[model samples]
Target: MNTSRLEAFSDGVFAVAITLLVLQFVVPDVQSGKLLAALLGQWPQLVTYTASFLTVGVIWVNHHTIFKGLRAVDRTIQFINLILLMFVVLVPYPTQLLGRYLNSGFNASVAAAFYGVS
Candidate 1:
């Protein structure tokens, strides 16, 4: 019935999800003179990474706030929280997809939609 364990587990999931977002950013292989240009080329990934990071951060804060108000967590609540954690864990995948296809015409739209749905 205690919420502490649930909150702690949720916090761990959030931390892992946020950490995974950064793994999407692979260092671009480029010559010294073209480093700036190479980095600039990955603007889409950077944008997606930032968006996903902020999204996870905001969700974590909100989850903490909501859990604080609950005196106890029931089985129903635990199941719902698991569902939420499932989605939280999935964030990085869609983020990577969106970033890779964000500028690729129709795929960009698909990726955006997928990102939104996720």
Candidate 2:
């Protein structure tokens, strides 16, 4: 197959992964007066969402850049690209975990590390 086919597939995966990131933002249950505070308190989720969104965007751009000059792709290249996409697809899961546990004292480190590894 052509490189364009691989790029297209990767693009779709990136789109889905980034789209899933936003699902982490839950509507807060709070009284009228405290709504703002509740929203503000979700800073961790917001931070993770922003970071993950930007990271995925950058990765997608870079992926395109790397493929721009390639004349053809071999089995090894296709396999490597699949591995990269595997990690890319896992981004949302770690992002959600990080957002959910980032503020937890000891758990924060682990969550951050998990996000970093992904």
Highest TM-score against the true fold, candidate: 1
TM-score: model 1 vs. ground truth? 0.97
List, residue by residue over 48-75, the lDDT tens digit for candidate 2.
9999999999999999999998878999
Q: How accurate locally, in lDDT, is each candidate? A: 0.95, 0.91
Q: For residues 27-115, could you state the per-residue lDDT of candidate 1 as single tens digits?
A: 88887799999999999999999999999999999999999999999999999999999999999999999999999999999999999
Check candidate 1 and list the clashing pairs.
none
Q: Least accurate stretch of 10 residues (summed lDDT) in model 1?
A: 23-32
Clashes of each: 0, 0
| Off by more than 4 A, model 2 | none
What is the lDDT for 15 in model 1? 93
- Which residue pairs show collisions in model 2? none
Per-candidate TM equals: 0.97, 0.93
